[model samples]
Target: MTHTLLEGKKGLIVGIANEQSIAWGCARIMRDAGATLAVSYLNEKAKPFVQPLAERVEAPIFMPLDVRSEEQMQSLFQKIEKEWGRLDFLIHSIAFAPKADLHGRVVDSSVGGFTQAMDISCHSLMRLAKGAEPLMRDGGSILTMSYYGAQKVVSNYNMMGPVKAALESSVAYLAVELGPAKIRVNALSPGPIATRAASGLSDLDNLLSVAEGKSPLRHLIDLEDVGNLAAFLASDRARAITGGVHYVDCGYEVVD
Candidate 1:
């Protein structure tokens, strides 16, 4: 059954590529929890795939937002300001790295590849938070997706491991800086799943199998598992919570 956990709240969800996206999961859950949502698609090609999902949540503000493009990013927040006047939370779930760099050893990652990955995957959170800060006049939460690789090496995770490490660190620094304003910041690190983004990793099947076998739960997590936690963190129920790298990894992070 749907709940009013987020009733009267307004949130912005960035990084929905398809139905299987982690951001899509969060959007669906937050919408069900009574949030008014403003959702973003990466570009025209992604609009078609993301539009239906946004409609399902009755998102009043649907637009294009490529975090790499300052113009697009600025336009998104401007639209939100015009339509909603305020924002209660922001969900950032986008990350990218060149395929060659991602599939290779982290030590061999090139300057361009590392820079692109860091900019899109880690620094984008800072940019979005900057835009959301003013709109969050009453305070807000900023949630970004991270992974286990950020803290520990996972074979084939490659350059993203370091990128995510930086993201988690950014979350801590952001939490401290924004705390006085009552703006909370945290990272959500979910276990392996077959999402489109995860497909980029080499030998993903093996990774999933290994995680399931080793995890205390003996299975991988689904989008819903991640969504449930995200919805909680986005709501006032977690008002006092911030500066954490909360895991929805089914106890996988606890094992050897």
Candidate 2:
């Protein structure tokens, strides 16, 4: 907790819904490590949920960013450019799928649903990276949230499996493209937690139970564990690490 690894860094944290959000966890840790932070609320509806947390982190620039809207995303970055003048790190913890597409089989998913899922969950990272690149004058780190389902099938994971797979692949490709600028990209694949997002998945209680039994740690991971890892990756300690899908899943991926 005494690490001043990011003392002089400036970062953007997107997709915090509430205190329980993974993005919130990363934000708190990044703030504690002494980084100046900026945060985005998805819209007016999400603003209430994110405001208090932003205050807690003392973020100077809080703005609205809906990745689907080029205007909104541009405005958010424009604000960043005006305020911070540069960006050192970014954490993308956003993903979404219409309930129908999320609950149904991949083959049964509608084109609209599939496209929306891919756009929000996978492609938005690319959009954000493009905007952040020019501002990362010295170099930076980009981290996105992912899950085990992206690699192997998990019952009830449905269409998101493919979506997250695409996300992880994007991390690899983006890392290669950005490496020359010293902009590192990585995907953090966390184990299931009872986050608001996970509540959308079918039979999540069973998944958690099974994961606990299967994982080497024998207990589910929590936000703090996630925060610790995220802080490390964003810090200079991880300067050499990039283009990897690092797991914070309590060894569950190794089981079976």
Candidate 3:
């Protein structure tokens, strides 16, 4: 049954690659919760895959946004301002690192690779928040995806561990910085699951198996699990919450 948790709310969802994306999960849930959404696809290559999903949710403002491009980023917010006037929440679920760097030891990661990873994975959230600040005239929540590796050494997670560490840290700092404006920032760290992005990790099968076995729930989590938490955080129900690293890891984060 759909609810009105987000009735009359407008949100922007970034980083949907396909049906299995965490962003798509959040978008689907948020839409069902009565949110009006504006979605972004990375580029033409991704548009075909993402456009259909956006339509399924009835997104009225669908555009291309490469976080690396200031032009595109600016255009996105401009369009949002023109169409929606204000934004109630934003979901950032994008991350990237060169394959060679990702599959190698973090210590061996090249300066270029690490920098790119940090820029796309961590700094982009800051940029998006900056753009969303003015549009959030009535306070808003900004949610970004993070992982357990940000805190612990997950064997093959590599440089992303540090990148995500920075992301979580940014969430804390941003929470304090934007608190006066009533803009909330938080990180959602979900346990391992198969996504097009996660497939980049070496021995992902092993990682999934280990998480399922070790987690208190004895199974890996699905996209809806993450979506439900994301929907709550985006709603007024969580107005008092911010600067937190909330986990939807099936109690896995609690397991030693």
Q: Ten residues in a row with the worst lDDT in model 1?
A: 1-10
- TM-score of each model, paired residue for residue: 0.99, 0.99, 0.99
If candidate 1 were superposed on the true structure by all CA atoms, what would the RMSD be? 0.8
> 1-256 in candidate 1: lDDT tens per residue?
2589999999999999999999999999999899999999998998999999999999999999989999998999999999989999999999999999999999999999999999999999999999999999999999999999999999999899999999999999999999999999999999998999999999999999999999998989999998899999988989999999999988999898
Candidate 2 lDDT score relative to the true structure:
0.94
The residue-by-residue lDDT of candidate 3 on 158-255, one tens digit each, is: 89999999999999999999999999999999999899999999999999998999998899999998889999999999999999999998788998
Better candidate by lDDT, 2 or 3: 3
What residue runs in model 2 are displaced by over 4 Å at the alpha carbon? none
Residue-pair clashes, model 1: 0
- Give per-residue lDDT, candidate 1, residue 209: 96
Error of 3 at 199 (Å): 0.2
Deviation of model 3 at 11, angstroms: 0.2
lDDT of each: 0.95, 0.94, 0.96
